[model samples]
Target: MSGTERGGGSTVDAVRAWRGLAETSVLLDGFHALKHALRFGARVPVALTSDKAAVLALAEDLAPDVTRPLETLLAETDEATLRALVPRLHPTSVAALAVRPSRAAQLETLARLPRTAPVVVLDEPRNLGNAGAVIRLAAGFGATGVVTTGTLDPWHPTVVRGGAGLHFATAVERVDADRLPPGPLFALDAEGEDIRALKLPDDAVLAFGSERSGLSEGLRARAEHLVSLPMRPQVSSYNLATSVGMTLFHWASTSGRPPGTGA
Candidate 1:
């Protein structure tokens, strides 16, 4: 099969399309990533695999909902050619390029009002993997979005890979602390109102500090309430992503609506 011919196009056409969009597109590195992205309505222009049959089989077993689209989308190429395109080819031997959502669109999403779920804010997070995990958590909890304050691009490839293509499931963007969405700010800290005693509101803006530091002075200043997760005396702090997961869970428990159900 010289590139799983489809729509009168061959591997050459797919490779050319991949190259054309490589710089401007988000790379869906593996079968699962592609699967999740497609489920969330990502615009995947080109999907390549060394074994189209295997990819389709995996999809049939794991995500039958997307199987037809995968069948129509996937283009098979030689393993060597596929590896050349993606240096670190995934074990599943599938890769694709998806259009990255525009920053303007994401900003609009983050700014939308009447939010039925809390928006998770990562204050100056330093770890790419942690940022990705937080995005995944936000998607799982049906949070309004995940906003990062700092230099790290939340949409970086490493972060996206960590997110397993769920970036499409939730709104994600980087913004200055002052520009965060409209909500009652709640910053997590060691010394604050005990989280157990306070019911986190659905539209709350839950902010967690970086791994090395608790909270930035700017973020702390903006917070209307300082919330603390329960901890024993000796423990210093929780992981950034872990802290987010707990806080969002707390909000979901009290919101009287199921997570991801949408208000």
Candidate 2:
């Protein structure tokens, strides 16, 4: 089999594999996304690129660690075919399909005790982009996981795109507020205690409300403590992702662990 072959099969076989797995797999769009996913131990079964040589060059320059794997996994295909496989072909002209982590495994990770990092919770977030950004932030801060309550699928393709393949770096799941892992729930609210005066615990469940409305009644009821981010009096609220970033920064700053060092 040639390097251009689909993990030992032909291009046709690669297309077939993509079609077979598209519905079940996570779409890793663009070179950076694929690189991040591969670095984080995501199982990429199929990867396609319009220009395998160029992509290999990119890996050589930016990600020497995954260069060999890219050489083996990337199947060269025509631009039109690549476009057909993905709704929008990334500017880098590379895309891949990665196996979504099992829900049971993520839940197990979330439920484990003595967590060294906080778990971020989005209370009924309405924006897919915000959810994705939060996941990215959670992954960056080495948070235990990112949990979302309400309708938005934490693993939605749009969210995945926004996350830039960092979802595999941390646990992500859509669970109700009651199902959140073992931790003291510190819900973010304008009326709560000033965050600067408090020391966020490693096992804290940092919850933020939706963009339009504040925390849902159910989540607010479950919260043991309410915390507030510092803001000017006239400002309404921080963006969902921004709030998560600030909270995680505060946690990491005081937790004695560098960001990105998982517990």
Candidate 3:
């Protein structure tokens, strides 16, 4: 873990393997992204680093839990090699390629009954950064997973970057409004019930709309209950990410034990 002359294969072999898998694999763009992904059980086939010693040191100091795997998984390479692998180099200069989770597996998890925490729904979200942020928040609060009903791929590179590789922590997938799993659908809207008054159930399907249009008519129709965040006065709406944060925070606080407290 100290030098630039470690890891399984030759630099050329490693680079070739990376290039071959680059299009299909999930790119862990930085040290933290790689760290989180590894901690959460991402199958990292190849990892590249310009500075192994420093990266391991950072891991040891900040995330000691992942230090050993980082030492094992990281393949030291030249700056040019690392740069060529990724579009823009992160400040930490560490990158890796991890296998994406099986969509069928994620769908099965989502479809399971007696869910312990809410599944956050992003109805036709437009922004990648917002989707990533919401996914990260869902992971933080121990929500079951994030389901997006729209054209946006929740696992897109930009969204994954924003999520900081925490997608491995929870189920993430896309489905139509009608295909959403069985649950009491509670859609978030401006003119709905005040969130403070209701106790968000552990098994709720909490849905939030896009930043631009709010909840869509189809989503609204699918919703069994429509809830709202408290607004002061003239403010039209909150940013999609922040709105999700507030709603999940409400769920966690009123949840009595935790977001995913077991029976």
Task: Evaluate all candidate structures by whole-model CA lDDT and list the values in order.
Answer: 0.88, 0.89, 0.87
Candidate order (lDDT): 2, 1, 3
Clashes of each: 0, 0, 0
Candidate 2: the clashing residue pairs are: none
Candidate 1 has its poorest 10 consecutive residues by lDDT at 1-10
Query: lDDT score, residue 10, model 3?
Result: 67
What C-alpha root-mean-square deviation, in Å, does candidate 3 show against the real structure?
3.0
Candidate 1 wrongly placed segments (more than 4 Å): 1-8
Instruction: Write down the TM-score for model 3.
Output: 0.95
lDDT of 2 by residue, 70-150 (tens): 888988899888888886888999999998999999999999998888899898999999999999999888998999988
Query: Of 2 and 3, which scores higher on lDDT?
Result: 2
User: Against the hidden true structure, what lDDT does model 2 obtain?
Assistant: 0.89
